[model samples]
Target: MNQYPDPHQGEPWQQPSGGNPGWGLPPEPHTGGQLEPYGNPTGGYQPAGMGGMPEPTEPTLDTIGDIAITQNTVITPSGRFPIRGTVWTTTDMSRTEQSTPVWAIIVAILFIWTCLLSLLFLLVKDTKTTGHIQVTVQGGGHYHATQIMVSNSAYVQHVQQQVNYARSLAA
Candidate 1:
């Protein structure tokens, strides 16, 4: 003995006749669901309000000056005066173990002996020296000074002090 009535036949809410299955209400009208295009749809996707990316602007002399001082370099452009700063000094050195030229080595190996050539190579030394300096200006620019003689550590310290002074002047 079945205690529950058959679902298809006994429930008034469950109508065998075609009708609303939920809440006994007529179905909502079919409305096409598509988002409205933002900005120019033909132009492709963009933020809802903004038209497009802002245009790039040219850099001014003040901007260029700031960059020059920050990068420690001078900027020279056509129809504009070159900007520079006070000079400082540094050094570059190179040492070579094998001082003899290739031809000398070949001739020595061929005529004299490899042992004598090796001895000559050991006796001679090759050294090169180069120097640079630092130049800095107040709110204008800073750069390493070039074409200067080898500077002692004292001179370098002085230049660094000057650079610090110039940098402190910037607002």
Candidate 2:
């Protein structure tokens, strides 16, 4: 055996020829595609349209807004409700109050031993809001209630605006 075989030499079956790149088989017919439902070249398969199977069609959907509403349904966080004859209700359950922060109380206690000026820290006031608004929808044999957390009166007003939009949609 030679360390480096001559490039001119190849297997007995190897021959340089530019006929068809297809492996030995003749070129296939230009049918729509290989995976098309057309009949095979052989007699076993039937022609495309001759088959008993029906052509498939995609179902179209009617939607409103981004994805919350459809032709007959109003999708919500709590559940789906009928858009027709639907009712929307909102209740504000938030309360706001002013109080001294825990850090301020702690600071006042730690510095009270040093001087009377430390008592001023107790005067620091913070306004905080806590609670959520409950929204309820009922119609077409269904009922659902969902709560939207509110941090301030502005957010409560925003929720009211959204409910108003829903009312318009229902009407």
Off by over 4 Å in 2: 1-67, 70-72, 77-81, 102-124
lDDT of 1 by residue, 1-171 (tens): 444445766554443434335533445675876545666655543322224543223343232212233233333321111233343233333222335456655555675554554445434444433354434232234233323233454544554564454344342
Q: Largest TM-score belongs to which candidate?
A: 2
TM-score of 2: 0.45
**Off by more than 4 A, model 1:** 1-100, 114-118, 130-132, 137-171
Local distance difference test, each candidate:
0.39, 0.66
Q: Which candidate tops lDDT? A: 2
C-alpha positional error of residue 59 in candidate 2 after TM-score superposition, expressed in Å: 16
Model 1 whole-model lDDT (C-alpha atoms): 0.39
Clashes of each: 7, 0
Report residue 90 deviation for candidate 1 (angstroms).
5.4
For residues 6-88, could you state the per-residue lDDT of candidate 2 as single tens digits?
A: 45856322433335243234445666634633455544433233155532322323322222555466765444545778988
Q: Cα deviation of 111 in candidate 2 (Å)?
A: 10
